[model samples]
Target chain A: MAGIFKVKAKAKDGVTKVKMLAKHVMETGQRKDKKTGEIIPAKFIQEITVQHAGNTVFSGQLGTAMSKNPYFSFTFTGGAKGEELSISWTENTGASATETAKIK
Target chain B: MTMHRRTVVKAMLACGALVGLGAVIPGAAFAARNKDAFSSDDQAKAMQALFDAEPANSQDIVLKAPSIAENGAVVPVTVSTEMTGVESISIFVADNPTPLVAEFMIPAGTKASVATRIRMGKTSTITAVVKADGKLFSTARETKVTIGGCGG
Candidate 1:
């Protein structure tokens, strides 16, 4: 599924706050294909991790029960004014996507 | 004359026995009503593995969601807990194919708050699981999905 994710970050007193939204189908494998009448294999983002300056800040395990296009917001402890925050997700089927944001 | 009185007493005893059995064996009375969600053994096992314990009743957790969801594809849900020493927060949809919906890890010294949108296949109870200081606590609210937005 093609979708968009937005991340907004702000720095105050050396702390950086971040929020993210990602688009995905998150099929639970229980739903059947309309034409084939076969169950669709479960496909979802199994894991999501966020790192700031190579330090793991947040991570989560996701399941097929999540809605399409999940959105998450969180805060990290430290960041400079222009440092890069790396975000990535790995789907159960091996598909992965990553994005980077600069502290503002 | 005495035999008729004895027969009536025996019938009353039988009725009392049936009522007692129904009360003791929960399955006998509400098996049909239990079909709202979580019917399969495998699904139950999966839900169990995600959390240390089954969802329990709680008064401190507040779950916010629309009483009637217009869209099943995306139903917004917000959960907040007043319980102290919280470790994690999770959400589950009883009517979905997989009841274990989402889990959040709340690091120590952070506020225990989570808000998200979930997909509902139909009318179901939305559960919030809170793990506080190694013990599991939970609360639930019923949400009615008016339209079958999960590809009905």
Candidate 2:
């Protein structure tokens, strides 16, 4: 599903800090079937990557164990004011999303 | 022959009683277990590989979370670390379906601070893993959610 993502980047003292929020269900699929009493299958975002100035600085593999609407904040070096950063992810079913922001 | 028939009937009645009891007991127990859920072994192992161990307590790390969350859908969490040479920061909800919530790699020569909102299916311990200069440091806090967020 197409979800909402927000990215904010701020630069100070030659460093850039980025904060991102992505909306998702992040279902673990272990929930019980209320009527039949069986476990549901797991589904969640499997991979996430953040790129700054064409270099991969951060990456992670998330499982169904993560809570819904995952949010992340981190900092990186060497980004001048107004540099563009790209954040992207691929869900378990191969669905993908990307959000970009400029250093402020 | 009559004794044999009596024995068979008694055994059948006992089996029926056992099945009925099993159905009722497990339902109640499952409900109780659902109230507090954590990741399975494999899931925990997967998270462990991605997460570096953080010792139970540290003075340099500050974990900010509500003492009690009225709603599980959105619980604000903030982790700020003062340790020098910090490399990364990560957050994990111990009792959520997925224990690995988010991992962040802090580039060299950058400040170590992260703040965000996360969902909590139920009451859980939130852990912060901080990687600094090739080593790991950590802290945690237990957050109680009155209403479940993920519909557990």
Candidate 3:
């Protein structure tokens, strides 16, 4: 199955910039369907982590306040070109996914 | 017999308290511990739950957001700092039902900066708090929201 994240990273001037877009609905459990008039259950990313060479560069604890299809951008020092960065995330509902991308 | 995830999580929390900050552990316990912060509707409750201390306003950090966001559903925000030994950056929207938006951890050697989009319920003050070198520093800015995003 295709991963739920689109990750891109680039290295320049001894810094690696990483940008990611996660696929999620980010329901807050407050909205109600027009037909059913019932509250929608909340589902969102509870945590996300990015690792370079087994060291954490960025990790996030997210809530429903984040917009749908959350996007994040961050940078770290000393990533070489073509080096692989591992990214993973676990949702509030216990679902998770992992993906990797190479620094350009 | 397999150990329940929640049981292991409880153990992780204990380990964290046992070992100052529990930097040695390698699980998602940090996130699990802050689960209550996500659901907090009150700013003080969320702040205390997340940092265990009050944050002081500082000029060292930069918070970038629109003065007036036409669409509250997708407001872009960025937090950056020149301070060294930074640990984490957290965003909060005062008017949202859940004040805490997100918290990003910055490991050593990583730049103390992050960018993301968030939802806002109305015109509100958005605060960015940075924990660096064991000190909490923060900055706030007002974003006028014409269209609320909470879908409520």
Candidate 4:
């Protein structure tokens, strides 16, 4: 299955910048559907891990306070052009997905 | 079989504690939410629970956010620091329903910088705490929210 994340990486000045956008509703279990008026269950990315060359460079723990379709940007050292940067995320419902982006 | 039943109960309790501990262990892969900190209304208590050590004010840390947020639902926040050996970065909203917002772990090779959008229930001070070399440093800035996030 195609994961919900669109990621980009670019190498510059000994640092590789990574930007990611994930599609998610990020329901905090507080909002109600307009038609049904029923509470939406919390569904947000709980954890994210970013790896390059089999080593984790960055990881994050997130909560419901994040906005819908979260956007994350960070930079790390030691990445070269065409190198693979793998990103993975696990949601509150125990669903997880991983995708890789080549450094530009 | 009585002993077996007791052992099963004991094992279940142990598993529960492990799950709870996983959440608070910063670098653990199977991280669970810091429920107490994220659910806390008091900023001080949330900070204490999230980072056991108090963070000293630091000039090395750079926190960027809007002076006034047009929409509290998605306020852009970016934090960066030149501190070496940065282990993690955490963001907190002083007046949110749950003060603790997000925490990021920066392994050795990663730069001590991150950007994300956080929800604010109202106008409040936003704090970015950086952990480096087993010490905590922080910077805070006030951002006015015109409309409340987190469902107000």
Candidate 5:
């Protein structure tokens, strides 16, 4: 399945900079459903992992405090043009998705 | 400057040794996510669940956060450190309904820096904790939230 993430990696000066935008509702449990008036259960991406050339480069755990459609950016050493980079995320609901990009 | 370099070198050597040891133990580069900490309203409980021990104050980590957040819903936070072998970095808000905001794992050769936004329920002490070479270090700063976030 295609994950809802847009990633771009650019290698320059021996460093690779990565930027990503994820499409998610990031529903905070405190919000009440407009119709039902019941709290909307929290649903958010709880974990994210990034790999390059089969090696883990970055990972993070998130919570409901993050804004909707979270944006993330980071830089790491040792990346080359055309290298494979993958990002995978797991949500609180146990759903996960992975997307891949090629370093430029 | 020389003293600082010496300290950094010593720290790096210590980290190098620890990283070697971690390689021998599977899953040592990462820490399990603490769901309870994210759901906790108590700061102490959240800290315990996340680190299993109190973090020591440190001058190494640089935590940048607003002194007064005009909007608590999207308070920008950035954490950076020069410490090598940085295993992870975590953010926490003392007064939030759920104190623990996020945790990030920094792999080897990656810069120990991360930027993100977090919600603040009210005026709070925002803490940034860094785990480097199996040692926990932290720094905290107070930020006044003008508009409550997290559904007020």
Candidate 6:
């Protein structure tokens, strides 16, 4: 469904470049609200992985130090046109989602 | 949290029943078992928890970052290496409360290059550690932060 993640992937000369942007608050649990002065609970993407043809291309384990709305780019070999890259992520709060994109 | 657990169970059932399980990679393959590493705060201990080894400084590992960052909330960092058989690439901000920022696993066919954004509390030395062929190599660069990102 492409929810929470936007991806652009293209393959050329046996190399595929994939770039994605994820919508996340990435609260570090250190920031305090101006009005209430209450500390925000820590919440962020703990793990993210991308796979093609049943093989993992890239995987990341993140911390609260990552910026909000995380963006990432990497390249892998052997992907082809019209193939789908499956992305899945799990956050610290236990929420997770899986999405797919077609390689151009 | 009861409602959340029920929803998760429902989703698991749906995923197990309908999908062919072809491309559905198991979470264990790249699971987040480094919660302690993420919260270690100390760079040396965090590195030990993450890689379980002391990284040897290497010039082959290239870490690119701004010499001066205008905003600490979002600083772009890139790590690349010419080394082959790269296992993973990890980012560390020495002065952050939690020094370890992120760790990326590079599969066999993937290139040893990664780019992402991170948060910095203030000016600090950022390091990129790469594990290749069962050995760790590292490089570091100093980034001057104009504004602190983490308000403590």
Q: Give the count of colliding residue pairs in each prediction.
A: 0, 5, 0, 0, 0, 0
Positional deviation of residue A9's Cα in model 5 after best superposition, in angstroms:
2.1
Model 1: clashing residue pairs?
A: none
Model 3 is docked with a DockQ of 0.60
| Ranking of all predicted structures according to DockQ, beginning with the best and ending with the worst | 3, 4, 6, 5, 2, 1
Against the native complex, each candidate's DockQ, computed on alpha carbons, is 0.21, 0.33, 0.60, 0.56, 0.41, 0.55
Error of 5 at A76 (Å): 1.1
Instruction: Give the per-residue lDDT digits (tens) of candidate 3, residues B30-149.
Output: 545476677678988899988889999999999999999999989999999999999999999998999999999999999999999999999999999999989899999999999999
Q: Which candidate do you rate higher for TM-score, 1 or 5?
A: 5
Model 4 chain B scores worst on lDDT over the 10 consecutive residues at B23-32
lDDT of 6 by residue, A1-104 (tens): 24888899999999999999998889999999888999988888889999999999999989889998999999999899999999999888888989999999
Instruction: Return the TM-score for each candidate structure.
Output: 0.71, 0.68, 0.86, 0.84, 0.83, 0.86
Clashing pairs in 3: none
All candidates' chain B TM-scores are 0.68, 0.66, 0.78, 0.78, 0.77, 0.78
Runs with alpha carbons beyond 4 Å of true place in candidate 6: B1-32
Q: Which residue segments of model 4 deviate by more than 4 Å?
A: B1-33
Top candidate on lDDT is: 6
Fnat of model 5, as a fraction = 0.67
iRMSD for each candidate structure, in the order shown: 4.7, 4.9, 1.1, 1.7, 1.6, 1.1
Kindly list the per-residue Cα lDDT of model 1 for residues B7-114, writing each as its tens digit. 999999999999767644653454422212222224355456565357667889988988899888788888888788877777778777667666777765445766
**What is candidate 4's CA lDDT for residue B133?**
93
Candidate scoring better on DockQ of 3 and 6: 3
Candidate 5 lDDT over B78-101, as tens digits, reads 899999889999998888878888
Q: Which pairs, if any, clash in model 2?
A: A29-A40, A29-A41, A65-B97, A65-B98, A66-B98
Provide the DockQ value for model 6.
0.55
Kindly list the per-residue Cα lDDT of model 2 for residues A1-104, writing each as its tens digit.
Answer: 45456777888887777787777777667677789887766667767887887787666545454557777766767788888888788876668987777889
Assign candidate 1 its CAPRI class: incorrect
> Residue B131 lDDT in model 4?
95
